[model samples]
Target: SAVISQKPSRDICQRGTSLTIQCQVDSQVTMMFWYRQQPGQSLTLIATANQGSEATYESGFVIDKFPISRPNLTFSTLTVSNMSPEDSSIYLCSVGGGAGGTTRNEQFFGPGTRLTVL
Candidate 1:
C-alpha cells in the first residue's frame, strides 16, 4: 500500500494570492489525481497528473488556474493561481491502487490541504 502526505495541513490566504500544495507518496504510483472538496459538498476531480506529460484538467477546471506537475511517480504539486474566496476548499491528492487484487478502482488519499481565501 502507498502512504500519501500533503504539506501545510491548513492555511489562510488573502484573495488574489496563490498557494501550491505538495503531495508525496511513499511508493511509486502511476496514476495520481487532484481533487477539491468544498464545504458541505462532495469531492470534485481537479486533474490527473501523469509523469512526462501535462496534467489533464477536469471539465470545470483550467490549467492556467490550477496548474499541476507530476515530476515523478511519488511526487506531485498543485498550484492554485489567483485564488479567490470561492476557491476556499480542501485540496487532496489521490493515487490509484496497484493492480491484481480486490483493490481495483481503489484509491489512497492524502490528509488534505485546507485553504481559506479571505
Candidate 2:
C-alpha cells in the first residue's frame, strides 16, 4: 500500500488568486490521478498524470486553468490558476492500487487540499 499526503490541508484564499497543491507518495506508483470535489457533489476526475508525460485532463478541465506536473513516479503537483470563487472545492490526488495501474484497480486518495475562495 502507498501512503499519500497533501500540502496545505486547508486554505482560504481571495478570488483571482492561484494555489498550487502538492501530492507526495511514499512509494513509486505508476498511475496518478487528480480529482476535484465541489461542495455537495461527487468527485470529478480532473486529470491523469503519468511520469515523463503531459497530463491528460478530462472534459471541462483545461491545462490553462489547471496545470499538472508529474516530475517523478512518487510526486505530482496540481496548480489551480487564476482561481475564482467557483473553484472553491476539495482537490485530491490519487494513485492506482491494482497491478499494472489500470482503472479497474482501487484508488488510494490523499487527504485532500480544501480551498475556499473569498
Candidate 3:
C-alpha cells in the first residue's frame, strides 16, 4: 500500500494568485496521479507523473495551467498556475496498491488540499 500527503489542508486565496501543493509518498511508486474534486463532483484526473519524465496530462488539462513535476519515485508537486473562484476545489494525490505483477492500482488519496478562491 502507498501513503500520500498534501500541503496546505485548506487555503483561502484571492483571485489571480497561484498555489503550489506538494505531495510525498512513503514508498516508491511507478505512477503518481493528481486529481481535482469540485464541490459535489467526482474526482477528475489532472495528470500522471512518471519518474524522470514529463507528466502526462488528461483531457481538459494543460501543462501551462497545471504544471507537474516528479523529481523522483516518491515525490511530486502540482502547481495551480492561476487563481479563480471557479478553480476552487479539493486537490488530491494518489498512488496504486496491491500484489502480483498486475497493478492492483487502487488510488489512496490525501486528506486533500481544499482551496477557496475569493
Best candidate, lDDT-wise?
2
Order the candidate numbers by TM-score, best to worst: 1, 2, 3
The 10-residue segment with the lowest total lDDT in model 1: 97-106
Q: How do the residues 32-109 of candidate 1 rate in per-residue lDDT, one tens digit apiece? A: 889999999999999998888999899999999999989887899999999999999999998884521215488888
Q: Output the number of the TM-score-best candidate.
A: 1
Ranking 2 against 3 by TM-score, winner: 2
CA shift of 23, model 3, Å: 0.6
Q: Estimate each model's TM-score.
A: 0.94, 0.93, 0.92
Which is the winner by TM-score between candidate 1 and candidate 3?
Answer: 1
Query: Candidate 2 on 8-112: residue-level lDDT in tens?
Result: 899999888889999999888878999999999999999999999999999999999999989988999999999899999999999984624434567889999
Clashing pairs in model 3? none
Off by over 4 Å in 3: 97-103
Clash pairs detected, candidate 1: none
**lDDT scores for all predictions?**
0.90, 0.90, 0.86
lDDT of 3 by residue, 1-118 (tens): 5667889888999989989999998888878889999999999999988888999999999999999989988888999978899999999998874421226756677778999999
Model 2: CA > 4 A from native: 97-104
